[model samples]
Target: MPIQASFPSQEPLGLNADLIRKYNQPAPRYTSYPTALKFKPIEDKASRSAMLADIEDAEGPLSLYVHVPYCRSLCWFCGCAKIISTNTALADKYLDYLEMEVRRYANLIRSGRKVVQLHFGGGSPNFLSPAQIGRLDNILRSSFEFDPSAEISVELDPRTLSKSQVLAFRKLGVNRASIGVQDINSKVQEAIHRIQPTETNIKTISWLREAGINSINVDLIYGLPHQTESSFNQTLDEVLGYDPNRLAVFSYAHVPWSKPAQKILERSPLPTADSKIDILIQTVQRLTGSGYAHVGMDHFAKIDDPMVKAQEAKTLQRNFQGYSLHADVEICAFGMSAISQSKNSFRQNQKDLDAYYKMLDEGDIPLEKGYLLTPDDQIRREVIMRLMCDLELDFQARGESNGVDFQNYFSSELDRLQVFEEDGLISFVEGGLEVTPLGRLLIRNVASRFDAYLGDAKQGFSKAI
Candidate 1:
């Protein structure tokens, strides 16, 4: 199932500003269908237990998402669910509650399913000491089985990440590491209040490579305050010199309502909308020109990168933690604010630490809100994911696989897509829909057409651009 992706191999992606501005509306990232914004309050324990039963009966491995929400300090530019504290003792206590939460799930998730993928995301997973990281790993291993070659990855903050911690990560079977190099320019760093010089990232990468963990990923952000195209190109040049295995060049989403820390950034002048677009266009051109294969939606990988392999083989998937290689693996997440994704449902842990601990102390899973997938949701999920990951959708083949006439069933949606086609963002092929290079930048807008619940509901999603 080689999904046809006509994205240019090394050529710079061309941009049409008129099309970009028209489609630069707010839209879900399609990381999960029905979107996290649709999650409702869990009715009772039955709903949760039923989801756990589905996970147990499901016939595949699991993907574990361990959220360590603690951070050493505040980066005003960040919008993640993070708790700022310099107190290391708080993390040790958090771990105790985390183990209890995992145990509660383990008692209910009584199955032989193993973990094929494991990701550690956070304010910063490296906020913990080496011993704490080891303890966290031990807690997870005791509850669930992990495949021998599981794709284990962690997010690191070079400022806080230590060589000893990197060694422990390698010893504990982590093969991939992603560090944030969100504009190494001193002024940008000062604006964000996270003063990490490029030397920090270099030292961190050296430690990781020395520990035999070489699948490196670096995250870059556009649309930051005082970011010019030239300034960002300098950052890109510095990062390209490192030759990362993969790159996630994301557009900054400034949502002050959800993340109060972001309001502080108002003191700094942000790049104008036009300036942001220029930065985005040049970033795409630079990465593609430098021989990195542009994987869907802000991610770029080397031709030999596993992510590129997954995209080519049609196994690439989007999740709460962005893109993943395993589409079938159900996610069982632990820790505060962590989201758990089952075959037909999604649930998140309590976000507040006190509330999270209270639920754990009561010997219950700290479930906050969740959404169950309808049958229509399941079908649409596959359809939208194919469009998102493979960058195309085969009507005939997908019709057979999904047991519906894709053309007839989605007739109205196809009609809606015509506006994009007219705008030159997408095109209709012989038996499928293909996103043109121009459309790739606004892929969310194209994927949004297939969303059943997107009925003029503003889900507070970031702009499609």
Candidate 2:
């Protein structure tokens, strides 16, 4: 079906300076509620065994996330754990190790455990050839009881995909494809060292649709070097022309000190904060005006999109994959730097491949760091998830009913959000706090106010724009 497009005629909204001032601070992306930084490594076999036990006890279907951390070339702005290499031999070796890891995990779980979602993300999952992806898919299906209706998704770099590759992915049961279209402007693309043209993207999108893969998602960035309102508008127009099922607009996090390769983007200019804000406002207006329902922070989709349906049913969930239809699936991450979350806690694999391989070879889980959620962590996580996903927190209702007083438990945090209330970003109601539309843009900041370990922790995270 051809996607409908419309632009709202309402005047653009301006940024709330006071809200921006009070909440425009660095914060975790909240891919995990407590954030991975809080995770402490499992020091012994006993602890690891307990963690595995928790995973075994969790009910319902599982989600599998496999990280293929390799790319043919580096996009200077990328901060993911990836290796830039042309060695097909290295990829083959990695595949063997990945298969071994998958088998190891499968052995740990009980029989009849079903996988509801399987995602391949990385420097680029499409970095592997068609046969390799097919091999990986077959391995997963053999090792786990994959639900035939499961959402099998993969992230692609259009510059690397071919027609045969798209068809192969469809045959492998990939129902969704997410392509990166950070910016259509050549100057902006050149600045980020990810130079994909309009035709390349168009062809890829068309090919995916042609191959019976209809759910297309396009990713765009707002704060890249050389990204101006005009450039972004052109990019948006170009992207809308392809009519993707979903759009993810993100703010570029410039952390040169952390991701050294980002230092390479020295010559091209970045939009000013106000200009970046302008582009954001314009983009949001454009998406909504075109009839795409605003699916909360940084996501837009057709009103009938599965994600939108999930949101309306209050079953929508946010995770490392952003918004998802499978909210409660126990995620088992495999590969270097991959993160897994069970009902009780979260665990992460070693960040570096060498450390990862070393641990796996030594008959260990290769977990570098992880946190076992305390009862308090679970409570706060529930509260934060409610606030983030629903844009409202029923502290008195949710807390007191759960045997705790909302104010007493989060007194200091409530005190912190006072400035936001004063700034008209959020409001305190009878038994809950509601995030005003203006506050939605600063949801990460608002959520951070409840973080017990934000400033004290030394781990760096992306900025909340």
Candidate 3:
């Protein structure tokens, strides 16, 4: 089914400042329903082991995530789990432990379970040397049967990413590369402590394409301190000149409560919520008008990109990594703070590197927290993910399949949605619900209505805007 292309609409989201101010509140990005905030401490290693056991019997292909947590220096705006060190030797040591962790899981995963998707994400996967990248790739290939057409991808920091490293990655069969440009403005770069030159970014993209890594993605950020509309527009223009296959225009989620490094931003004049919303509006208009398809939720893709195809087909999926085209594969992640999701459970590796190493040295899974989805959690996840990805829900059909009454099962939640309905964010469509074009900008706000745990949590997450 071709994805309904009603979005990327020339029409505005109709989200005025007052409406945005009223609705802009802390909400989960819905990368996963019952977001990480709801995860409980894993009381026993056996629970994780049992999850591994299920993977052994599962018949589907796998998605492997390897987290590389080392960065040469800190990008103060970074919210990801990372360790900053100038020492290259640390990567070699980290790789040894990472290899051991992969081998440990390889023993549990069935031999024939082909890896269909492999992603290397981190503080910066580029932190590793060419030789180190080669070693990691070899270790993984030797341990698992990878599909010949597996989608192998890696995230890189363009500042330190070298052409030699890019070539090595290409030789290792990396078909996709995501580079962090963040912002090309000099002031924004200095403020964020990520001083990457525009020439470097253009060269990085050029090298990736020359290496035959055709699916290139460049990331741009809005709402950073020192970001003006003109500066951001210049950054966007510079990025567009590279003509990346995909663009991830993300809002700078300032959660100083969770990431103390972001506290530095408090000292600077960050954009107001109203201004941030304006930047978002500008982003949508620029990208969509430039012939890129808004793939929803901070992503834009060229018309022929697979992500656009997936969105059209309704097969697009969301995960901890943000958006993915591979929906059926179970993800098995290695390294500190990495999350592994299977059909029955979600598990995370220890967040502390020393603790993770200690646990793995003792021959344990190094898992710290996770959630085993209840039947109810699974059902709610379905509802949340659909509204999030497809922007529509067929309540009666979903209820029939899940063996629950559409309206009765969610009476209170539906009652809450009445406000949004009244506000024109959503409407009843074919006995179900659909997010209006005006509501697409506030999709997270719409999806949050289906969350069962939001009411009980007091922890502050990032704002929806």
Candidate 4:
């Protein structure tokens, strides 16, 4: 059965210079409260042990994030940490090291926490063969007690998928597949060097459906070179024809200075700020008109989708994967450059594969950087998360619930948001601040108002849009 869309379009919204000026500022994605850049390098075994002990003491089920950094080819627009390789031996060796780290963490947390959610993100998880995926699944099961109904999901590169591989994913307990389809325009595809045809995507979608895996997500990107309002509309039309359960419409973050491959793309041809805003407004209108419920920033879903339900119930959570079903679970991330968040702290694995392998070879849990959150960090995190997830925050309610005086703790931050209140971006009511309809487009900016580390001169985050 097709899921009904939830967003309704009334009038086509225009992007004026003032709107562009207001929204054209840099901001973090807020995947974590402090963000990964704030994490300091772990000094010794004691710090690492303390982090592991915290994870061991967590009260509920855990979430696992495994990063597979290998990719068959590079997409110029991508800023992800990935290694391009066709060598099977390299993958085999990487898996060995990954298993070692998994075992090391398992031993540290001896109670064997049950995994409630397991996500495989990548360079491309599909870069591994079906057999390799199965073997990796075995490794996880061997080390942890996976809940029978755990949401096991994987990010797939459609260009590399095979029919057998699709079946193998299901057999290996993958219940969700997120496929990347940046644009269907051939010219745009060529410009980005990611020439995925619509036929391939449709076939993969059909196969996954036939395999009884209905939780399909399609990722689309706007603001790429050669992308125009017409081109994007066409892409959206084709995407809507597929009718995915979830849609992630990301704005392209072109940071050629940071990500060298991005230099391959000609900067001049990329859309202007006004042009980008036009595409975004049009895309949002189209999705909403098609009955897709706006599931906050960069995401939309059918009314019946679990994410939509979560949003309505005010239980939606934002994580590295974007919006998630399991937010409260302690995230245990494995592989190079992965990050795990416990209740009180954040821990990250080694970024370089060589460094990661070296640590595991020496029987150490290759953690590179981390932060132990203070009580203030927790309070600010709660406020920021509420704004990001629910677009509202109850100051007094939070204070009462968490036993922290909201005004005393965040008095300066609240004062900072007064301008937004004046601009009608937010509402200051009796006990809380709620984002207005216009504020939804500036959620990241609004959330950043509460981030203590965001205003530093050294911060190099992307634009909030």
Candidate 5:
């Protein structure tokens, strides 16, 4: 069935300028509690094999994440693990190694394990040839049985996406897609080095819909260079015309130290901190006012979309992909720099392509780093995920489930929140604390309070605002 959607009346959010200014310092996006920055290097494959064995015995449903780290060229503001190249031979070689890696895991996982979700994400997943995408899909399907309700999705750059590729996605049973159109303003696109015209994106969505791919997501970046309030409003209007089922409005993280390409943006006239806040306010007003439900931080979905349903049902989950609906499925990631997650641990593949290929050639998993969640890590992760997804926390219920007083356990964190509470971004209710609408945009700051690894506060994380 096509994913249905609706948006109820919009709630007025308090845009606390003062609070934003105070808390708008470097902070993690909280995709994971410890975050990948805290991942410890794994020297061998024994632990990985053991974990897979444990999972196989449990025999739960699964989610597969395949990373394609190739892009035709670099977008100056891009921070993802990506390789900017157009060499088909390079891509073909990577896929050959990827097949070996997938087969390795497939052998470890027992037969007939169901895959409920599969996602292809990267620098640009569509950079591969049509046949290449099909081959990857076939290899995965051959290894695991796909659930009838499986949701297959991909992230593609509209500038590089083509009609034949859209047809290929349909052939592979891709039901959902996210297209990148950071900004429609020519100057902004020029500054960012991603020059996709407005009509090109509209046409891409049209093609996907015509090919029976109805669940569409469009990504927009706020706080980019030359992004004024007026220009951002115009971009929002242009994007709303596409009427996407889901929207991800991300703040442009300008971490030159982490992503050297971002250094190119240094010479450009970027928006000031206050101006970025204005742009964020404008974006929220436009999207929420236009009938898009504010599902959570930087994410909006149609009221009836599965994400919204997940939120209403309190089953919403947050991972590297941001907000997601399937919480029961363990994630298995393939390709260089892909990160996989099970209930007990998070593992990452080798970030270097050469190292990844060498490990596969040596008949071993190209595992580089991972974090095995301790009992404490798991509890803290639960708290952070809840605050991020549901925007509220029931202290009593949380404590009851874990056999500890949540308030007493997290007293320091709760005490730290006094600043947010005083600033009116958050408030205490009947049994627990509630993040006000003002706190929604600053949810990362709220979630960070519970992070045990976020010491020093000097780490190179993006700003909260």
Candidate 6:
């Protein structure tokens, strides 16, 4: 179909294959302004200490992320930095280092700052035994200050998850869970090298709810090898039947250059580009048509979900963990390959396990690369994040916030966006801009317009379809 540039912005998102192909180009995910691609090497240990000391006096509650970099097996589609291991001994050892790192931060971060959010992301947190899970939780609770009602969430690989582990997570104050359910089709699972049975996901979710941790989110990936429109719809059907509170249906990010394991999929007959976009369009129709709000860029949530509430109130935030409720808090991360975010800086821990363990072994911070946002970077960040999360921007009002003449400052960018406006992706209002429903799917492309570093250096990013 040809583009429909004249559609009313209030109309529900409509499929335009022309628009999909036109906007489907590589772009940074913008999980952070300037993105991780722009991060630079850290100078010294004092810079690390200074980062922590800086956090001591910062405003707002703290958000903590724990990275367990060991997975029982490699999932070909995974882009996360993870080690494939079954050694309980390795996790136990890693936990010791993780605790040391956490304690180091705890000592630096004053007790007055309460932790508002805690997340466990992984190779798979489910890879840990029940005791290890408890031990990791105890280390954090004993070291850091936590709000009683904080949202504690964990990412679980259903294939490795157990009822005991879920119970242990509940006991440790985990209230939310994200289970991987990429596809239920046998051929699709075999193609991706993540042979998860549908029953595994079903059983795991049931265990989480039985343990009273009811807020469950399931992740699905479209455009995988051997996947089809009908197969994916069936996968969606099964997942929706799981009755998840929120869902993230991501386009399979095929960055085989960085994650060499993904090369395995090249041997399989993958869906053609046209077929994939058809699946994407149908997915939006099925999800939104089923009453789930298209919660920006591949995420969907029920009408009453907290994420929907946050987006409606314009308090939703996009971070390394995807969309989050906390807006202004500093995110401090633990373990190797974890990235932490503060008001002005982004820092990632050492990605190599040996180096990561070495740093903590010597009582040093495991920082590898960091970036401090410049004033211009900050302004662009605000504009881009507003577009990505809030789905709109008030130029005159936001101009006052950034102390710039919005139209004059972004004049060039505005001129560049004429194509989007013409394509009906964005609409100009009286003194601001509103991203139309169709634009939300391509918000990364829309937001990348404000990125000062986005020109010709977008290496390792997935296409924006």
Please give each candidate's TM-score: 0.97, 0.92, 0.95, 0.94, 0.95, 0.95
Question: Each candidate's root-mean-square deviation in Å?
Answer: 1.5, 4.1, 2.1, 3.6, 3.3, 3.6
Model 5: per-residue Cα lDDT over 240-344, one tens digit each: 899999999998887888788899987789999999988988888778888788887889998778888887666788889888887756888999999888878
Error of 3 at 43 (Å): 2.7
Q: Give stretches of model 2 more than 4 Å off.
A: 1-18, 400-403, 455-459
Q: For candidate 3, give the lDDT.
A: 0.83
Candidate 6 per-residue C-alpha lDDT over 33-147 given as tens digits, one digit per residue, 9 for 90 to 100: 9788888888876666666666666667899999988898888888888999888788988988888998887777765788999999988988888999899989998988799
Cα deviation at 68, candidate 1, in Å, is 0.4
Instruction: Please give the ranking of all candidate structures by TM-score, highest first, separated by commas.
Output: 1, 6, 5, 3, 4, 2
* Residue-by-residue lDDT tens digits, candidate 3, 410-441: 88888888888888888865577778755666
Say which prediction, candidate 3 or candidate 6, comes out ahead on lDDT. Answer: 6
By lDDT, the better pick of 3 and 5 is 5
Off by over 4 Å in 4: 1-17, 110-112, 456-458
Flag regions of model 6 displaced more than 4 Å.
1-11, 45-53
Better of 2 and 4 by TM-score: 4
Error of 6 at 422 (Å): 0.5
Candidate 3 regions with alpha-carbon error over 4 angstroms: 1-15, 456-458
The per-residue C-alpha lDDT of model 3 at residue 202 equals 81
Give the backbone clash total of model 5.
2
Tens-digit lDDT track of model 2 for 165-278: 898889888899999989998888888999898899989998999999999999998889988888789999989999999999998888899899998887778777777777
The per-residue C-alpha lDDT of model 4 at residue 424 equals: 65
Q: Each model's C-alpha lDDT?
A: 0.87, 0.81, 0.83, 0.83, 0.85, 0.85
Model 3: lDDT of residue 143: 93
RMSD of 4: 3.6
Which TM-score value belongs to model 2? 0.92
